[model samples]
Target: HKHLVQALRKAPQTAAVGFRQTVQKLAIVVELLLGDIPERAIFRQAPLRKALAPYFQLTQAVRLGNLQRFGEVLENFGPQFRTDHTFTLILRLRQNVIKTAIRSIGLSYSRISPKDIARKLGLDSAEDAEFIVAKAIRDGVIEATLDPEKG
Candidate 1:
């Protein structure tokens, strides 16, 4: 189990893909390396799971497909966060989190404005929030009609 965690720490970093793909890769690693019969077995082991509880939460958040919860779990990771290649994926995942937040708002308000989404997401500017929403749409994670002039 220590070796399994070590392998996660040692995995090479690369440009991150979508959260679904990232979760799939992490699940595969846990299965292939740890003899975990089920794909999400790391989350099942109480001892090793305790040592890496935040990661377990991360997987849970990903599994639930809730970006808001993913952002909350990310806050729990705190300052001791790992710098492993896998960890870098969170930096990219954050963008998706932002997009998810936007989608949630859109669900409530069909013609929601970018500034409103930015305020809700706590982003620095409306432009950044709009950019994230656009990216999410481009990635096919969402379907939204952009209104640049209204924004």
Candidate 2:
């Protein structure tokens, strides 16, 4: 990704129009690669940052476990995501968002029912919440046990 960014930056002025078009698509890919990093140097480029605002917003939503905002970002930027070949990758982050929510819930409460988790995370069913929580525990994202009969 850095190589691509450097190549784009070094492109000749004669290819300014092509550079602009490529930057539109490349910015999101770069943003995705840099999302978890603390010092994201990409944002320093004002035009690239402007182009990547929606992708940046999506990352923020994932980090915060804001499912509603996540959905909104996906809806708003679906075309851009598809064009940049990142739609599937972005979709996969849904689980991360759920796990983040689970971690928050685990920190806040010692005991929480799957039904309550379903409601809190906007999941379709308690069974779904159970599965997500079980995965989170298995993956070491959280430490919790699901008492099927109880929660």
Candidate 3:
């Protein structure tokens, strides 16, 4: 438990591979934590159910490999998670679809058009995608410069 706290605190310093591996590890750890909880303690108790809902939801998201939902939970119930002593762990799992998309693009293309990037990332508009691409480049997530005229 103390190790988990340490790991979460250091997550921002972790690279993409580190983030992936940590999430996998935390998923298993969460499973173990859940397995240790006595079933009778939570059974048929409304307040207990409500209190445990976020944990259950987070576990489900990790189990189901739903990073989007995991991010949503962190975004929505951050305060609740903090009170429950799981906020740092949940907060460490920052799911950025754009970042994932950028990684995929870097692997597949040397130079990609903005509209295509938008389509791959599921953005509603190419302009938005272009903005994201420029931001990503500025942030060093993507190494290539955006070609506005070409895009």
Root-mean-square deviation per candidate: 9.6, 3.7, 11.9
How high a TM-score does candidate 3 get? 0.44
1 or 2, greater by lDDT = 2
Predicted structure with the largest lDDT when compared to the true one: 2
The C-alpha stretches of model 1 lying farther than 4 A from their native spots are: 1-42, 60-80, 83-85
Model 2 lDDT tens row, 1-151: 7676676677774557456546645554444444442234544456566666766777677778878888999999999889777788778777766777788999999998889989999889999888988988998989878787877
lDDT of each: 0.58, 0.73, 0.59
lDDT of 3 by residue, 12-115 (tens): 63355444344434543354344322233332344335545666666555544344676687777778767545566555443343454576687789877888
Report residue 57 deviation for candidate 3 (angstroms).
Answer: 9.9
TM-score of each: 0.56, 0.76, 0.44
Worst 10 residues of 3 by lDDT: 35-44
Measured with C-alpha atoms, the lDDT of residue 96 in candidate 3 is 40
Task: Select the stronger candidate by lDDT from 2 and 3.
Answer: 2
